[model samples]
Target: MESDKMIKPTVSYHLFLYREELARRNARQLRLSRTKIDITEELISRTVKNIKTCSMDDLKAVNRELVFKRKLRNRVSKLRKEAKLAKQ
Candidate 1:
């Protein structure tokens, strides 16, 4: 009986935390959405096109952008999965 009582509170706490996390994620997703996904791809493509021509700073900047692009893609995919889970 004690275990059953503990389970309910734990489950409620889990859901509460999940909801709060999702809310923060959704907000970030909104900001990320401002830029089209393709923009990153295009930027990478352009960077590659100018690879031999780019200065060290340009290359470093592009590298940083590439890292951000991966992070953005991962976050978007995660948000999609969470949305699907919420539907169920």
Candidate 2:
């Protein structure tokens, strides 16, 4: 009887679970949306050309942008992991 009581989930408990699932899905979607840059071959070629032809200051700016994107990716990955663990 005690086990049965513990095993049965209430309406509020169901709602909480639904909310948690929604939050997880939202986090996953946010990560996808934020990182969805279409890096085609043309873009890569353009970047290579820019690197070869750009001034030192332009190269530095590009380096900074790359670093910023790296950090953002890391942060998003961390957040996604945290969200995954939280679901458990």
Candidate 3:
């Protein structure tokens, strides 16, 4: 009867330890999940900012090229008129 009583207490103690360990594991997992979400949000913000900056740079480059081409076309037309007058 004494041994049976001791067995119950021992089993309860082991169960308590198991519960504590599971709680710690769950807390650790929660922390890791939170960190992953934070990092992902930061990365997304940075990527969006980079894309906006790159798009602005691309627009500026295209505008500059268009202006340069227009000036080149005007110069070519003037030169062609001069050549025609010379031939006459």
Candidate 4:
């Protein structure tokens, strides 16, 4: 009877710990999901703004504009890569 009493409290303690740990993990996942959603929204907003601003002129001009944007994006990506490497 004494061992049974001791085992019951031990099991209850472990169950409580397990519940707490699961709750913590769930909260962390929720925060990460929210962050990803926020980033996605920001990217969409920026893309929409760029599309709205792009002029639809002559084909040559449009091509030139696209090339320029591509070059600029490549440069930015290179810079980001360099910065990340430096941090490492």
Per residue, candidate 2 scores C-alpha lDDT tens digits across 1-88 of 9897688554455455545656783545443423332122223335668686778876666566666666656776777788789899
- TM-score against truth, every candidate: 0.59, 0.48, 0.38, 0.35
Worst 10 residues of 1 by lDDT: 29-38
Counted clashes in each candidate structure: 0, 0, 0, 0
- Taking every candidate in turn, the Cα RMSD to the unseen true structure, in Å, is 17.5, 18.0, 33.1, 20.6
Tens-digit per-residue lDDT, 1-88, candidate 3: 9887665434335455445655784543333333333343434444556665667665565456556555555665666677689799
- Model 1: what TM-score? 0.59
The reply for model 4, stretches above 4 Å from the true place, is 1-57
Checking candidate 2 for backbone clashes, the offending pairs are none
What is candidate 2's TM-score against the reference?
A: 0.48
What is the alpha-carbon lDDT of model 1 when measured against the actual structure? 0.66
Native-referenced Cα lDDT, model 4: 0.50
Query: How well does candidate 4 match the true structure in TM-score terms?
Result: 0.35
Candidate 4 structure quality by residue, lDDT tens digits, 61-85: 5455456555555665666677689
**Of the candidates shown, which would achieve the greatest lDDT relative to the real structure?**
1
Choose 1 or 3, whichever is better by TM-score: 1
Taken over the whole model, the C-alpha lDDT of each candidate is: 0.66, 0.55, 0.51, 0.50
Winner by TM-score between candidate 4 and candidate 2: 2
